[model samples]
Target: METNEVFEKVKGLFVEDLGIDESKVTMDAKLEEDLEIDSLGIVEVVMAFEDEFDIEIDDEELADVSTVGQAVNLLHSKI
Candidate 1:
């Protein structure tokens, strides 16, 4: 998948599942700091991504992914 496609799908996941404003779901937006997603919410987001992309994301793989761009890059790489 293209980087932009990954970004858009991840952005949609954030907006739909987390109720985040699309305008604030920028490439640099921090998942915890900017989006205020708690630990449980993070798990939910991860699961949602796994379902949406039909890919598996282990916890270790997500340990350092704190930003939207980072998550997009990870997903892109997996695809």
Candidate 2:
């Protein structure tokens, strides 16, 4: 899938599932700092991504993924 496509899905997970504000879900936004989502919330969003994309997501793969763009790039690569 294209990066933008994966981005929209990840954005939706943050906006819908995690209850994060839509405007804060930008590519450069930090998942924890900018979005104010806790670690557990991040895990839940990642799980949502795994389910939606039908792929396994290794949590360790996300250790360095602080920004939304990085997460999208990682998930896009898996797809």
TM per prediction: 0.95, 0.91
Give me the overall lDDT of model 1: 0.92
lDDT of 1 by residue, 1-79 (tens): 8999999999998898778989999999999999989898899999999999999999999988999999999999999
What is the C-alpha lDDT profile of model 2 across 1-79, one tens digit per residue? Answer: 7888888998888888878889989999987899987877777877888899999988789888999999899998998
Candidate that scores best on TM-score: 1
The C-alpha stretches of model 1 lying farther than 4 A from their native spots are none
**Model 2 misplacement above 4 A:** none
Relative to the true structure, how large is the alpha-carbon lDDT of every model? 0.92, 0.87
